[model samples]
Target: MLRSDAAGNALGAGRLKRMIRYTSLAVALVVAGCATKDDVDDLALDETPAEVMFNEALALRAAGDVEDAANKFSELDRVYPYSEFARKSLINIAYLNFKMGNHSEAIAAAERFTTLYPGNEDSAYALFIIGESYFRQIPDVGRDQAVTGKALQAMREVIQRYPDSEYTKQARQRVRATEDQLAGKEMEVGRYYLTRRNYLASINRFKVVVTNYQTTRHVEEALYRLTESYYALGVVNEAQTAAAVLGHNFPQSEWYQDAYSLLQKGGLEPQESKGSWLSRAFGNMKLL
Candidate 1:
């Protein structure tokens, strides 16, 4: 987006006329919205006080001119960098950009606010906006999860840095969602390897869900997959351990049933190994 107004600099006759027309429209809009004469003057002229500019931007937003409002806030920030209005304008820019679905711009603006005013009360909100921007851009489990990782990290930062802030609860929720997506991605890859009879590779992937993402919803399926992979590799002890873990943690889960049935097919049952990583991961839960 253009940083400076075209009319702010020297203009040719044609450009001047266009500016006049646009200015007239802006003035008409403010006037129609029951704005005072001063408000109309602020919209029609280049000489806006910081407070007036901030109010004008708010009026534009209220009038549903979101893009223009964001631009107006940007201009206010640029013109009054050290003023209190600048800080307010910067946060508004981030919020409006996010509302407009300009996620990247929202992230940039929010990051800028947080960096400039780390101690400000609005800094937590700015950080939340950055995390929300990344969360909104998260792709499906099939895609690279770099954005998901960033979202998770950003949300965690909000919780860690501003635990008492209003945004912390939602940030914590987003953290769980992002972690679930990452675990789902691993599960997808693990499933692919399993279908190709790549037992060891599949085991490695499912192990991630069990180890690093045990809190996620995918953990039950991850445990089942681990059982499947280890059984395919003729590692019966580990297979039993995995199935036992699944049954112990998710007794009613369909995945546990499947794991149990699979073991039964081989005249085996869900039994925990005396010493196994799966046992250690689940605090060595009792055998099923």
Candidate 2:
């Protein structure tokens, strides 16, 4: 009886040990399987061909998934750096970054494309993209206009290097817009100085508009401000010359009318002053 009882106890202990071992093995296998699945999910992109990855990025962009599309394009370029698809991917990434309002990234990618493929037909487009990125970041005239200046420089590069490109027309338009923005910035500063009763500083700002950005929309206002500043400084001849230039260039402008009225209230008339900077400029143009 005692021997049978001992034999039953040993048999039960062996069965328990075997069960624990099997359970541990099963748990370990499950954990390993999950870990492998996680790795596979992480590396799923590794198996895709460059063309396939590029196409996927394009589809994502078309579907308005800009962030994902940019990531995929970057991934494609990284995975196949020497492929033609990689080169194309870089350009698409630039455009996508621009669309995503990532102006700095767009500029970097566009610049990179231009650097790598200087002779590519799309280099003009890349340069245009850089200009557009900077142009879009241009702040209000009340703020700094450093980005506007950069946009002008980039757009000028496009027009100068690729005159016949389709991008040149758009770049030229952007250049004009950037110039207007810069002129507007100058006008803002000039008006501030004028309001502060600093006629000399005001004249300097307004003169920049007239001399450097004469073709901008702000020219009429700048000329009117110049007239106001010179009059405030008690320089009647310069005031009259400024008013004359304003009237000559923008005869139908409200600014011209305002200048004329202000000069009339001072019992003075608009006339070109010989030997003045304005006279030299307008005289050369035969407009005075």
Best by lDDT: 1
lDDT of 1 by residue, 1-288 (tens): 553555556445545754675577666777688777676555543446789999999999999999999999988886566789989999999999999999999999999999899999999999999999999999999999999999999999999999999999999899999999999999999999999999999999999999999999999999999999999899999999999988888899999999999999999998989778988888949765
Q: Tens digits of per-residue lDDT for model 2 on 1-288?
A: 356878989878856754665456556767787545554444333447788999999999999999999999998987677789999999998999998899999999999999999999999999999999999888888888889999999999999999999999999899889989898889988899899999999999999989889889999999899899999889999899999988887899999999999999989889888868988766642344
TM agreement with the true structure for every prediction: 0.79, 0.75
Query: In model 2, what are the clashing residue pairs, if there are any?
Result: none
Query: Where is model 1 poorest over a 10-residue stretch in terms of lDDT?
Result: 2-11
**What lDDT does model 1 reach?**
0.90
Root-mean-square deviation (CA) per prediction: 10.6, 14.7
